[model samples]
Target chain A: MTETEQRAGTRPIRVLIGKPGLDGHDRGAKIVARALRDAGMEVIYTGLHQTPEEIVEAALQEDVDVVGLSILSGAHLTLVPAVIDLLQAQNMGDVVVVVGGIIPEEDAEELKKLGVKAVFGPGTETDEIVRFTRASVGRA
Target chain B: MSLGQEILRGDRRALARALTLVESDPHAADDIIAEVYPHTGHGIVVGVTGAPGVGKSTLVDRLAGQFLARGRKVGILAVDPSSPFTGGALLGDRVRMEGRGSDVFMRSLATRGHLGGLARATPRAIQLLQAFGKDLILLETVGAGQSEVDIMGFADTTIVVVVPGLGDDVQAFKAGILEIGDIFVVNKSDRPGADQTMRELRQMLHLGPQRTWLPPVLSAQAQQEIGVAEIADAILRHSEVRLTDPEQRQRRMQEAERLVRDALADQLVRGVVSRSQADGRWNEVLAEVAERRLDPAGAARALHLEQD
Candidate 1:
C-alpha cells in the first residue's frame, strides 16, 4: 500500500494555516506551515487573501485540529472575530484558533479574550510555534 | 434529517458536511455513500487539468461561469497537492474563481496522504454534488503528472490546458497527455505563439491515432473571455458523444478495476496492521527487514501475506 492509503502511523495532528483579509503577506504563514510540518503536523494552507468564510470552510473540510491565522494587515481585530463567529456557527468554536504576525501587544490580550488560544508576534521562533501547537492541539 | 436524506433533498450545508466526511474519514464516508449511492450519477463530470502557471484556475472559472449562465448548477472540485514530505499543502485554486454563488458549490481539497486521493475521494465528492442537485461537476486537478493521469479516470470528459509561452509543445505533451485529453485548450491564447501552438496541436493530432472521436485542439484566453465559448462548445460536444456498448462495458470494467484495487489495498494494510500485535513477530519481522537481515519479499512470504 502506498504511504497515503495507510493512515499515518500516529494520526498526526492536523492544522489549517490561513491568511485572512486583503493582507497578501504569506511569508510568515508559509514559514509557520513549514515549522508545523517539521513538528509532524499535517498543515493545510489556504493561500493569501482569504475571506473569513473561506478560512472557516477550509478548517471544516480539512478537519483540522487547529486554525492558525496569519494576519499582518492590522485587520486581525476584524478578521479574527469573523473567523471565531463562523467557527462557532459551524459548531467548531472549540477548534483551537491561533494567531501569528504583527500585532500590538495590547491587541494580543484582546485577541486572547476573544478565544484565540495563543498569539506569536515578531521575533517569535518557529520552534515556539511548534511547541505551542503540540501541547495545545494535543490537549484540545 | 439523516445526512443521506438531507443530501437527496438538495441540502447544500449537508452536502458540504458529507464531502468533508468523505475527504477526512473513509469509514463514515462509506456509510453515507451506501445511503446516497442510488440517488447519484445524475451530473455530467468533467476533469480540467494542466501544469501550474497555465491559468487553469481562470479557465475553469470561466467554464463553470458559462455553465451557470446556461442555468446548470455547477460543483467544482479542485485538488491541490500536499507536500509528501511534511504533509503540508496550500489549496488556493478557488481564490481566482468568481466568488461563491447560490447555484455554485466549490470546494478546494488537499490530497491528504492518499496516493490516488485525487481520484479516490473525488468520485464520492462528485456523487454528493450529484445527489445535491448539481447538473454539472468540474474536477480540477494540479498540472500534468501520474496522479493527474490517475485522477482523469473518474471524469466523463477531460480537458487538458496548455499555455503558449511557458514552452512545451504537442511533442512534449505527446509523452502521455495527448492520449488522455478529450479537448486540448491553448489557454492564454492572446499571448504570442497562440496560433503556432494551436497548429502544432492540430498537426500532432493528425499523426497520433485513428479513432471515431478526434480530440479537438481549441484556443482560449480565459481571463479576457476570449474563445471560452468555443472551448465550452468543444467540451459539450465531446461529452455528447455516445459510448458504444463495448466501449461502455470497457469503461465500467476499468472503473470497477480501480475501485477494487484501491479497496483491496486499503483492506490489506488494515488487516495486516490490525493483526500485527496478535502475530507477535510483526515488529521483529519489520526490524529484520529494516536491518536488511531479511529481504522485504522474504519477510512478506514468511508472514503469509499472499496466502489469501
Candidate 2:
C-alpha cells in the first residue's frame, strides 16, 4: 500500500466529473478528471450530454465523495441545481458538488446558493481545481 | 455505536466508506471487519467471472434487478484493472446499471495492481455489504486472468460466464477457468452454436475432476433476460447447500490464510523492490536470472527485503 493507503480509514477519494446538459462539450470534464486522477483521487467521468437523473444515479451507484459538473452551455443554473435536488432526494446531501466551465458571475453565486461547493470559471488552473478538490474532500 | 454498528443498521454512507477504506487499506479494514463479522454471513456472495465481452455486467445487472423486484437489496462490486501508466481507472460497468434505482448499491474498484485484493478485499467488500442487509452481493472480476480463480474464495456460488463462438472446442475448455467455475453459464445463448458450446462444456465438466457440486452448465440470453431466474435459483441453491458444508468452510479458511500470507510477504518486499529499482539493481538481477548466472532463489535470499 502507498503511504496514504497505509493510513487507517483512508481510501482513495472518489470523484465523479460529469457533464449534465444537452451541450455536447466534454473537454472541460475530461481535463478535470485527468487532474483529479493525477492528484491520486479515483475519478469517474461521464461523457457528453448526461441527464441530471443519470448523473445523480451514477453518483449514488459509484458512491463518489464529490461530483464535478461541467457545463459550458449556459445551462449551469438549471442543470446544476437539478443535479443537487436529485442528489438530495437520494439522501446524498453530503456529496460535494462542484462546477467548472463557462458561467457568469451572477450564475456562479446562484450556484453557491444552490449548494455547489466551488466553481471554476474561465481561465482557472487545473492545479487550483486539484488543490481545492483535495482540500474539499480531504484525504481519501 | 461503532462504524460497524452503523453498517449493520443499514447506513448507506457508512457502507460506502467501509468499501473505500477496504480498497485502500485492507489491513486496517480488518479491524472494522472483526467488529462486524458476526453480523455478516447472512447474504449470499456470488462471484461472476469470464473473459471480457462475456456479458457478465449485463447479466449481473439483470440478476440484481430481479432481486430488487422481490424487495431484496443487492450490492455489486465491479473490479477493473487500473491503468499501469495513470494508476487511474475508467469504471464503465456502472453504466449498465445506471437507471436501476437505489436498492442496488454498486461501486467500481480498481484492481490497484494486485492479484491479491481480488481474493482479499472482495470477500471483505461482500461482508460489509452483507452486514448492510443486502440479500445478495455480486462480485464481478476484472475480465478473466489466471488469478481470477481467487474469487471462489469469497463467493458461496461462483458463476463463470462464457459466450458461444469465442473459439474452437480446445480454446473453450481451457482447464484453468473450467476447474474453478461453480456454475458454467453460456451467455448470449440465443446466438448460433449455443447448444454446441453447452455440449462442449458438459464434456469438459465430465472430463474434469468431480467435486461435491457437479457445476451445472446453464444458458442465458442476458439481453432478453431469458433463463435468468433459473440461474438465480441455481445460485440460491448452491449458497443454501454450502452453508452447512464443512468442506466449504475449510476451503474458505484456506483461501483466507493464503491471502494473509501473501499480503504480508508483499508488504515486506515492496520497499526492497522499490530500492532495487531506484538503485538500478532490479533489471541487473533479472538479467542475471534470465542468463542462469544467478539462482533466482539465492539472489532473492541474498538481498534482504529489510536491511537490518
> lDDT tens digits, residues A14-62, model 1?
7888888898889989889878766656677767888898788767655
Judged by TM-score, which candidate is best?
A: 1
Q: Residues B1-308, candidate 2, lDDT per residue (tens digit)?
A: 77888888887778877887787777667778998888887777888998889998899998898877767789888887765555666666765654665578887887766673263467688888888888788989988634577776677788989888987755856767788788989999988899999998998898877777788999998878998988988887887678767786787778679767876886777767677767777777778889999998867865564344
lDDT of model 1 at position B213: 83
Model 1 TM-score is 0.84
Model 2: docking quality category: acceptable
TM-score of chain A of each: 0.92, 0.93
Residue A34 in candidate 2, Cα distance off native in Å: 5.7
Candidate 2 on A44-66: residue-level lDDT in tens?
A: 77667788988887787678989
Candidate 1 structure quality by residue, lDDT tens digits, B1-308: 79988888876667877877787666667778888888877657888888878887888889898888887888888887767676656566755776554457777776765565373478788878888888788888876533357656788888888888665564457556777788989888878988988888888877887877889888888999988888878877776673543476777788879877987887776677557646676778888999999999898777765335
